[model samples]
Target: MSSRRSGISEEEINELISKLQSLLPETRRRGSGRASASKLLKETCKYIQSLHQEVDDLSDRLSDLMSTMDNGSAQAEIVRSLLRSS
Candidate 1:
């Protein structure tokens, strides 16, 4: 598949991978690094999950606000029409 079709450029993917790798805990000894890396990965996963929830919440709130605005606009138009008739 081409990068254009994939919706993500190669550079962006690589950059994201690099960022995830950087989140891994660093150690001088290779044998003891696994525990730290695992813990860091878990933390990163939790953070990402929280971010997803936040985005969902924001989206819902924005939808509600837009709906409210539309209703208000319709009500205002009705009021204006009633005034003009009177």
Candidate 2:
């Protein structure tokens, strides 16, 4: 039940690989052709990186929107004070 690669059983390795493959949508699309663990790991790294970038982009956009809204409210308050004095 031991594999030469790492003294781990084949079943254990296959179970781990299946878990990894399930995380990847592209791998599921390949249908019958299996991806090596190395490729799957690489794809996972890229997928994680893309998600990280997306989160950063969204956060920046949200901050920008909040800043704009704050400024707009301040301007409105300034105009109200001016109208009251006149």
Q: In terms of lDDT, which candidate is strongest? A: 2
Candidate no. 2 TM-score? 0.64
Residue-wise lDDT of candidate 2 within 1-86, one digit each (tens)? 34866788888888898888887778888875778889888999998899999999987985675566655597656755765796
Which digits, one per residue and each the tens of the lDDT, describe model 1 over residues 1-85? Answer: 9878989998896666556656543422233333444555676788778889999998798567556665559765675576579
Candidate 1 CA-lDDT value: 0.64
The parts of candidate 1 lying over 4 Å away from their true place are 1-35, 71-86
lDDT of each: 0.64, 0.79
Scored by lDDT, model 2 comes in at 0.79
Worst 10 residues of 2 by lDDT: 63-72
- lDDT score for residue 75 of model 1: 68
The window of 10 residues in a row where model 1 has the poorest summed lDDT is 25-34
lDDT of 2 at 30: 81
